[model samples]
Structures are given as C-alpha cells and as structure tokens.
Target: MAELLKAGAVFFVGFLALYLLIVLVVWLGQERMIFQGHVLPQHYAFSFKADFEEYSIPAADGAILNALLFRSDSSSRGVVLYLHGNRGNLSRWGHMHRPFTQRGYDVLLIDYRGYGKSTGKPTESGLYQDGEAALQWLLQYYEARKIIIYGRSLGSGVAAYLAARNPHQLLILETPYDALTNVIQHQALLPLPGCIFRHHFPTYRYLPAAEGPIYILAGSHDRLIPLYLSKRLQPLIGTPENFKVIQGAGHRNLAAFQAYHFELDRLLLP
Candidate 1:
C-alpha cells in the first residue's frame, strides 16, 4: 500500500508538471492561434464596393492598417465602425455590412494589423489601438457622437473596449464571449482559471463603463460560442431588451436569418 501510494503521488506530480508546460506553450503560441490571415496579394481588389474609399491608418506604435469606408447612397445617419471576426480580411467581412449601408449608414471596416494589406503583428492591446485609430480617422469626416460601433465574434471584445473608452452612441455585439479566457475554458472538458490566459480580451470587464446603449445579438444554436455565455451578459447590462437570442441560428450564419435583421431593425429604428 505504501509503495502504491508513492507511485500514485509521483504520477500526479508528473501530470501537473506536464499540464503546466502545455499551458505555457498555448500562452506563447496564442497570437498565431487567435489571428488567421492570408498574405495580401499585390493586386488584391476591394469588390465590397466599387466606390469604397480605402485609407491606411497608422496605429500609435507606427503599424499601418488598411481600412475601407463604405459610403451610403444618401447622406448617412452615422458611420458604423465594424470590427470583424478572427478569420479573413475587411474585404470578406464587408459583405456582412450591407444592412447598415442599405439603411443609409456608412460602414467602416478595418483589417487588423497583419490581416489583408495591414501591417504590424496583432496583439490584444494593439487591436484596441487600431480600433481607436479607425474611429479617429472617421472623426475627420464625422463627429464622434455620430459614430456607432459594431463588433462580431472576436471583434466583439475590441468593439466593447472601444465603446467603453469612446463617446459612441450605440454598441452592437454579435456572438460576443464574456472574455477570451472564458471562451477557452468553456470549450475545454474541465474549465480552468482565467489567470493562465495571456491574450485577455475581457469584454465583460469593459461592459460596466460602456458609454452608449448596448445591444447583444446571439445565436440560440451557436456551437462555437454557447448561448449561456452570451446570456451571462444580460445581468451586467441589467436590461432584458438589450439582449436578443435568435432561434435556430448558429454562430456564422446568424445574418442569413430574417429574424436577425428583424431584431436589428427594431434596435436601429427604435
């Protein structure tokens, strides 16, 4: 029995050490794991709009990010600064913004540093800087109060953080996680403490001080970002009307549903 106990203790210690090492590796390689972007071809075209005015905004750290400003058919209500998901570039994500443009709201979509034509390695803090830079560039043509920020998936954290810091009028988050740490833990068989995460896009942390009205649109059938996680945000915002969960909608295909736009219209028009 004494020998068996000693062997069991040794096995437990070894497993703990191996687990810590795995966590360390995940921490170091997280940036690459988080951001997936293709190399920008020299002839990369912006087919999102023919008259789409492209600009190169400089971050505080001197990284140059490429952004697209989609003008409305008529004079706009405001510009929607769209922070998109982790995959693809602004050009791909721009297809998702036609609802805003069709409503006479100009949409500004940005490629995070290292995505599409943008330069500089992407970090959590650097993403926040990129968002601010895009907003400031928009302010050159529109007032800060006129801008409404929208974020989807990975961009939700960036959008929430920006809305909290800036004077935007409205904030719309689609399938946003409570935090990146929460995302990783929820997907795991056994959840871990959030302290191990290095790339902390804590959207919940910023929601408390968000300056504008907050609207959350989440999918009831979202497999990637569970509905319960999105539901957790309701307590923080303290308003049932601010949160909406669409039936039979998944993470990537929520926009395809008519109910999605129905909810959006209620929020935008109301």
Candidate 2:
C-alpha cells in the first residue's frame, strides 16, 4: 500500500508539471490562435462618397501597419481612431462605416500586426505600440480636430493604454475585458495559481488615469467576456454615467442591438 501511494504521488507531480508546460505554451501562442485573418468579401463592399485613403503607419518598433482613413465630405465634428478586435482586419469593420461616416465623423480603422496586411507577430506590447503609432499618425496628420478613441474586445486594452498616455477627445470601449489574466483564467478553466499567468493587459489599472470621458459597453450575455467582469469594472470608472450594459446580447452580437446603436449615436454623433 505504501509503495502504491508513493507511485501515485510521483505520477501526480509529473502530470502537474506537464500541464503547466502546456499552459505556458498556450498562453504565449494564444494570439496566433485567436487572430486568424478574415478576408473582406467583395459583395459587402460599399462606395465611399468622400475621399478615402489607405495608409501604412510605422509602429514604435518600426513595423508598418495597414490602416484605412475615411474622411467625410463636410467638416467633421470629430475623428474616431478605431482599434478593431483580434479576429479580422479593418475591412471587417465595414459595417460600422456608414453609421459613423453618416454622422460626419472621420474614422481611422487599423489592422493590428499579424492581422490583415500588417507585418510582425501579435503580442500584448506589440499591439499597444501599434495603437500609439496610429494615434501619433492621426494627431500629426489631422491637426486641430477632435479625436475619439474606440476599441472592441482586445482592442479595448490598447485603447485604454492610449487614453492613459494622451487625453483623447473621448474614449469608447465595447465588450472589454477587465484584464487579460482574468480572461485567461475564466476561459481556460486552469487550476494553476495566478502567479504563473504573465500576460497582463490590465485595462482596470489604467482606467483611473484616463483624463477624458470614457464610455464602456458590455453585453448581458457576452460569452467571451462575462458580464460580471464589466459590472465589477463599472464602479471603477472615472464617471459612472459612461458605463452601459446592452441587454440580451452576446459579445459578437452587441452591434446588432438597437440600444447599442442608440448609445453609439449619442456618443459619436454631433
């Protein structure tokens, strides 16, 4: 009996070690799995009434990022610097073009590194650097204009980091996670201790430092990011009125919610 117990203990230790190794690999390579390219379908394309241009902005690490700039025909009330989710490129945000453009807001949608035509591997810091570079490009090129920063999902962390660094005209985060670590813990169902999770995109940590107005939108049924996470972060926001929860919507379907459309219109419209 004693011998059998000792063998069991050894086997358990070995299994734990192997499990941890697998987790580390998954954590490091999560971006590759999460951010597969989504090619733009020609059927969904729309004609641009105003002058639209594509740009290749250089990141801080010297990576060239692909971006689309949509300018309104008339004087725009403000410009929206859009950081999209992990799955697709700027073209995927084509659905958002008419709504924002019709409101007379210029939108700059960018494809993060490793997504779409941008070069370089996707990492937590790499995305942040890409956002900063995009913001700098907008600031330098579109001077004397109001700028609103908008992000969804993973892009929310990048937007929050930028909001902390610079005073944006406004900050809008949709279906954002509290932190990357929390997201991994919830999704992976890992039993490992918190000390081992290293990728920290702590949007909560930077929220307080944001000097401008912030609008946080979350879905009640968001499977990817739990509603409770957004609920927990809501009180931590600089202003409580900025937070909103979309009813009966999940992470991907929030855009279809009429309340979401109304809130977006209220926030982004002149």
Among these predictions, the greatest lDDT belongs to 1
TM-score of 2: 0.84
TM-score of each: 0.90, 0.84
lDDT tens string, model 1, 1-270? Answer: 999999999999998887777677666767777888765864687785436888889988999989888888987888899999999887678686688887778988999988999998888998999999998888898898889999999999999999888888789999999888777766654555566677889899899888868999999999888998888888776466889888999999988899899987876653
Computed on alpha carbons, the lDDT of every model, listed in order, comes to 0.85, 0.80
Runs off by more than 4 Å, candidate 1: 1-25, 193-195
Local accuracy of candidate 2 as per-residue lDDT tens digits, 1-270: 999999999999998998888688666766655566564432334344555787889998987888888876668877888888878776666456566777788889888887767788777888999999999988986652388898888889999999989867888998998887787667777654666554578999888888778899999999888988777678767788888999999998887889988998898765
Q: What is the C-alpha RMSD of each candidate to the true structure, in Å?
A: 2.4, 3.9
Candidate 1 global CA lDDT score: 0.85
